[model samples]
Target chain A: MKQKNKKVNYSKWGYIFILPFFLTFFIFSFIPLVDTIRYSFFQYFRSGLKWIGPNFVGLENYKSLLQSDMLRYAGNTFILWIIGFVPQIVISLLLASWFVDARLKIKGQQFFKVVIYMPNLIMASAFAMLFFALFSLKGPINSILISWGVITETTPIDFMGTALGTRSLVGVMNFLMWFGNTTIMLMAAIMGISPDIFEASEIDGCNSFQRFFRITLPLIRPILAYTLITSIIGGLQMFDVPQILTNGAGSPNRTSYTLIMFLNDHLKSKNYGMAGALSVYLFVVSGILCYITYKITNDDDPDGSKAAARKRKKMERRMK
Target chain B: MESKGYNRFRVIFAHVLLIILSFLCLFFFYILIVNATRPHAEIQKGFSILPGGYLVTNFKNMISDGTYPIVSGVINSIIVAGCSAALCTYFSALTAYGLYAYDFKLKKVAFTFIMAILVMPTQVTAMGFLRLITKMNMDDTLFPLIIPSIASPAVFYFMYSYLQSSLPLSLVEAARIDGSREFRTFNQIVLPIMKPAMAVQAIFTFVGSWNNYFVPALVLETKSKMTVPVIIALLRGADYMNRDMGKMYMMIATAILPIIVVYLFLSKYIIAGVALGGVKG
Candidate 1:
């Protein structure tokens, strides 16, 4: 009886303690989410200020997104994602491996680490401004190229003016914005590998490259997968860089336009219904991509006695 | 013996490569700093590696022009960031502690809710949130800016994981046996022990709040209430294309100074916090 009373008292306190978060989450997060779904189906106008009726536009918004020029925007986003995500992971892994290798006693390791990570702290707007100044046609980059006689004096290369050039510029922005964070995460993964494995590999006469490929990469494969999946989701949701760099116009004939920017444009145009549809589309696409990535990586642990037994056998063999 | 020589070469090559990458990073920083100091003509003349002497003049112009409020925006940013961080950290700790210490049927459900919410990007529900705020007449106030952040799903998840891994259940059991109420126990015991996680979360929350632009841009219409990112973006639009390069660079420099200063001082915590947040996410 006393224990039951204690349990009741504890449960009541738990409710009280968690009330603030639950209340705030419902008001701020969950309700809005429900409303977003509801608004996506209705036709909203600027003057109505009311959500009209229960107009069921079941698949119309999705159809429009599929047929609209927004598909081009999605393709551009994927291009940026490929350019950014692939190199980011590769370069970050290389850096991480180099930092951890026992053979290389690089100077100012900590300083370099801190410096690389500094950009991550700056607001995206500020980072965009810095890059804008650097990449402007009359900016230092072009001037330097001209002074060095690398290019003819007549034609100045416009970094943000061309389609491919603008895409690559956005790629550079993506690289700079995220590489530091990746390096840091990759570094943690590298550090987590037990020294025993490295020692054993050394005893077996594995060189740095060999060891990295055979041991380190496989060991950190999980972290790499995690980074890749997250970066993909983040890349798909790319907005701020293009938003600020292109001054929210998506620049150079919307070549730098992302799905989020497209959504924002719809919202600004007071087409909340279409905007909601676009957001839901993005959400679904991201979800599907995340699922595909997980499947490709095979990161999920399988259930059932057979799978568990197979895992135990493998562990025993590895232990030997 | 040949392999040893090759290994030495490889080490040299790696260092050289890393050095180049580091230089690239520093080069960008140099560009920002130099641009902050140089005259508009020099800035437009392409990249100037050297700092010019117009920094003071630029600063005076930027401040006096009212395009960027160095003083007011910083104060406003501090208030918003500080309040959000405190509330977020406190509530996250509370929820995490509640979930950690208690055994209830809702435990699994609550944890799943937090994780599910984590996957929903802010943009997905932003329209709904805006509408709700407009109806509540909280559209123009800082309440919209600071309130939603208080229940950050990411922070809650972080606190939950930290509580699970680092905190021992014995501590909670002992406090409960001593007849302490749950809230008091958490306040007196659990919180003091969770200082490292709290410190890390506080800095992360503060930085995120400070650097936030989109939500604030959509919500706060007034200039005075604008955070640093919004103010800086607006200043860029008004000053940069308008040929007020002096004010533009000045605003940019002043806007970035707080983050740079904070980062320079608390880089270790910030890096750790970022790593933790990344891993949790």
Candidate 2:
């Protein structure tokens, strides 16, 4: 009996420890997510001061969302994401490779990292406000451009007033905010490669360009894929920057309007059904995009488990 | 091997590129700081790279402005962000320690369950969350903002990895032999050992909750209840009368000041934390 008492199974402790996290997650996130899906099927909304039906509407909300400007908002999201991401990934890769290159012997790498990452710490809302103030007709950018004679005072560029200008600013802001983070992550990925591998590749007469493309890029593919998937999900949820920058209007013909902004518009109007459907659409679209990115990045790996399995199957077939 | 000349050229080229990028990173912030010190008329006149004398004046104007509750906004932001960060780090660590310290029948399922939702964006559940909060009468209050941080999947993932590398099962076994209760062992022994990871994650969680705009904007309709970001949005969205750029810049500067100060002190840990999270993520 003493021995049995001494041999306590500690597994229940694990459950007890993790209970609060699971309980909170289920209550706060998972249940709401499931409910969001349920709400999408109902015709719940408010008309003026009157609460309307949560009556079963089946797919009516989804049908209406599809017929509306949902696709355009999605396109805006994708375009904004692509523009920001291209520059971000490119610059990050360049900076990451350089910083990680021991031969470069870069000084003050920490300072550079800290400085670059500072923008990311600022609130997106505040960042948007800063950009708005700076790009206003009377703001600093125009003032400088005027002083430089790039544009006359009378014709100062209306940056937030045009679709291209607004999109470009949003893109630029996103790039600035994220590139540092991407750089840091990529640097860590690069550093995880053994020095012996690089030495061996050097012995094989691989140039820097060749080494990066043939070794570093392929080795870091998993992290890259992870980065891309997260970025896509984050992009799909893009809101505060564009929302605040455009004054919640998505103005200039609503070309800069994002899916979340559209959802926000519906929510503001107390249209729960439409908002729920839009949320579902966002979830589905991000899921598909993440799946595609994962497949594309993983399937082509020469040394991956899937490839190995394929090779093993071929070998078995030959033996048979 | 690459020639000495080629290596020198590459080094110089890399330095030049890094310098230019670093300059670009700091330029806007520099502009923001410089503009924050000047009065509205001065800011509207033109951009200045130099500091001005009206910093105190602008700050006073922003804090004392009757239309916007900037002071309450700051306090509300602190309350929400502070509570969220503490709960997020503590609960995430507890969850990670559970998976780390013990074996259970559903251990693998539990680990995978948390990880599978790692990429789930909060936006996807906004409507539902809003509905939940409203139904619970949680809107216009900070409860919803602070309470849901208990299950941050990303933080839990980081903590789990940190524990795997830093902690040994022998420590727990030794504690059990010494008659330390499981919960007490975690609190007294494990928590202290996890101080570094907790600090790093706490800073990140704090900043994240501080900058969170969407959920708060959706939930908090009352001016006094709004966080700093929400208040900044309101200030920006206000009519032309309140669109004082200097005061706005001051407010924005004040909003970002805490994060900037924290970053200045703990940037080394924060960068390392990102790198750590990134590798396993």
Candidate 3:
């Protein structure tokens, strides 16, 4: 804590307070992040007890990384997000707007909130495994599809076998898992918007949709940007869904293999150099996205920080 | 202008749409629970809408299966999740209080560094970190799982934001004026005030650690040492248990019960949190 009256430097306490976090981060997170970059440059092999080499390969690993399916894997991951988050955002926004609209007396709001958000509480891998069994050829889904004459009993469709099938299944899971959280977040944003804005828009003869697009959307842009960027970053780290759904195979010709899955494959196969390169690739891509998010959201912050600085300034002004 | 009848129709339509969506949201869980109670052969006969009488049988089978060691998996999960949640929350809050309460030169840089780590994909650092753990001979131990969570950027960010909104610096200054030690003040005074934030973060961290299969799958070599998700994976692969799909569904249900219970007990706080919203923001 600070004292306005005490002028001598007491920042040592600040350093002490924050030491555990930094020390732990230094050992576990920062070092590994640096190691990922460092390990990317060297070629290595397993040889008995002693490792054969982490000899300087320079950009050799990077060069070969370009030739891999990583770019495609990244694309597939984006496609999955597009499929998943589009419906997610649309539904969440709609639900949120309705709840925010007072005229729409949506009863049982609390119940629906709990029910919808329930799925997010469980492990993604557990859900994936549940779906894996549920969609098996002899399982309930295929049996029903056959009964409904959607497909023949003779050749049951392999839901996890084809690329599109696998992607769609994962997409559906993602959509289901996320939409509620998105709804809650959007609702929160709407709640934060002053009620007067909505009333003014209504008085100006703006319809519900117009008010939503012109007023609510514009004001909540920061939140929207935050969600989108985080989702993009999270989409890149999609591992548990595809990994478990395909039983670690990344099947259907690895179409469901995300960037993490691809790197995990490298990790599993002990191709340390190649895995390191992929890790760096992922880090760079995510860093760029984070930077873009930072720039977009902090455009108005003269200090080049976010709202925290502004809030602190306000606090300081209040104290004065 | 639209007629009153048309407005009524529109409102009704929206309600129906939401109702259907909620049902769809809950449908999978319904099936999973139902399937858990159905006999393995009955499960093969395609989807049935209601519960069957096989839950006890499935539970017994799970317990009796010498190969799976599911009880140990549950215990292991509780230990890992519980420890990680406590360490992550207390230390994160302590660190956040550090930044929030104090004035320091490198404060901004430290804050930025934490934010960077927030978005920095764990997959990027996972390999090197794993190697370090193995080198330290910490592989296959819960220490590796529980220890690193103290540096959780996401949790730190949450605590930082919570402290920003809730904790007034005047209180800290008052405590200091009374000659309360810095760490003691944090532990006794600030921590009690941070209960709601801690509870929310604790549930999140606990569920996340409990559900985490990736790192555990990598480090744990022995079956006895594995968590529930990994053991579920084992059961799925075991050809003998393949016939016991009911057991599989039952196991999944059992694994998630603690999470569901926590959710039920603390969902009001969580909904409040949902409204407050998000580590990234």
Query: lDDT by residue for model 2 over A28-121, one digit each (tens)?
Result: 8888899999989999999999989899999999999889989999999898899899999998998999998988899998898998888888
- DockQ of model 3 vs. true complex: 0.58
Model 1, span B119-163: residue lDDT tens: 456887778888899999998788888887767777887898888
Expressed as tens digits, the lDDT of each residue in A1-320 for candidate 1 is 23664534466666777778999989997798788878787766464565444467877776777789888998888998788777778888888888887777767787878887877777888778767766777667788888888886677788888888878877877887778899988888788889999999888887777888999888777677768777878887787777787888777998889888887777666677777778777767665765645453343452246779889999999999
Tens-digit lDDT track of model 3 for A200-286 = 877788776678799988877778888898888889888888888887666788777788888877787667788889889888888
For each candidate in turn, the TM-score is 0.91, 0.95, 0.92
Error of 1 at A213 (Å): 1.8
Angstrom error at residue A303, model 1: 12
Q: What's the candidate order when arranged by decreasing lDDT?
A: 2, 3, 1
Query: Top DockQ: which candidate number?
Result: 2
List model 2 lDDT by residue over B1-281, tens digit each: 68889989999998888888889878878888998899888887788879899999988888899778889999998999899999999999999999989888889889877766777778888888888888898888999999999999889988988899989988988998999999999999999999999999999999999999988888998887889998888877884323577788888888887799889898898999889877863
Q: Each prediction's Cα RMSD?
A: 4.0, 2.6, 4.7
Q: How accurate is candidate 2 locally (lDDT)?
A: 0.88
Better of 2 and 3 by DockQ: 2
Say which docking band candidate 2 falls in.
medium
Can you give the lDDT of residue A159 in candidate 1?
88
What DockQ does predicted model 2 obtain? 0.67
> Which predicted model would earn the best TM-score?
2
lDDT of each: 0.77, 0.88, 0.83
- Per-model fnat list: 0.51, 0.78, 0.57
